[model samples]
Target: MGLNHINLVVKEVDQAVSLFADYFGFSLITNRNSKMAVLERSHQFVLVIWGQELNRKDEIPEYPENFHIGFYQEDEGAVREIYNRLKEVEGLKLDSEPKKIRNTFGFYFYFEKLMIEISVNPFKENIA
Candidate 1:
């Protein structure tokens, strides 16, 4: 088996849902009372968003300093396109512009408390 799904706990469910849907092209699979949402990408991968209610303070979780979700494209141009689109997204914060990182072209940014990275695998064309 590869991987099933990932659940992300966020402060605002709608914002997180919108951001992911816009960037990853996910389709909303389920919406539960404005508190939870399930999104699907490519039919095989699932992303579940859980809203942390302020009334339940103890249930809120913290993320590690470098924790992030990543997405990969096939080419450098696609990565740049995503970076540029991210720059245009209102209220979203970009950590930096796209640049060479090791052998890939990529960039990272913040979506609320989550860190997101999108990159292109430079060696993809070399794979047999």
Candidate 2:
């Protein structure tokens, strides 16, 4: 079987669900108040967003440096398109403009507590 769902713990489930819906076209499958949500995209990819609750304040979760979720576009232009779209979102943190990184053209940005990377295809050769 192919890959299944990905679960992310975030500070705000409502905001996170909205972000995915607005930017990635994911639709909400279900929501448990503001505490959690299940989102689906492409009919196969499932994303779960979990929010902090009062009782769970003692536990701390951390991601390693450079840890991020990446979205790959077909080419450099598509990557730039998403870059521009995200730039218009007020309060979203964009680390930098899209630039050549290793073999891909992309940029890094953050939404709330999550780090995100957007890149063009990294396997192909001679792509600008």
Name the top TM-score candidate: 1
Give stretches of model 1 more than 4 Å off: 58-61, 126-128
Which residue segments of model 2 deviate by more than 4 Å? 58-61, 124-128
TM-score of each: 0.88, 0.86
What is the number of residue pairs that collide in model 1?
A: 0
**Please, what are the lDDT tens digits per residue for candidate 2 over residues 17-117?**
88899988899999998888999999989999877663386343466787889888888888889899999987689999999998778999987757998
Ten contiguous residues with the weakest lDDT in model 2: 53-62
lDDT, model 2, position 58: 34
Model 2, residue 29: distance off in Å is: 0.5
Cα shift from native, residue 66, model 2 (Å):
1.8
Candidate with the greatest lDDT versus the true structure: 1
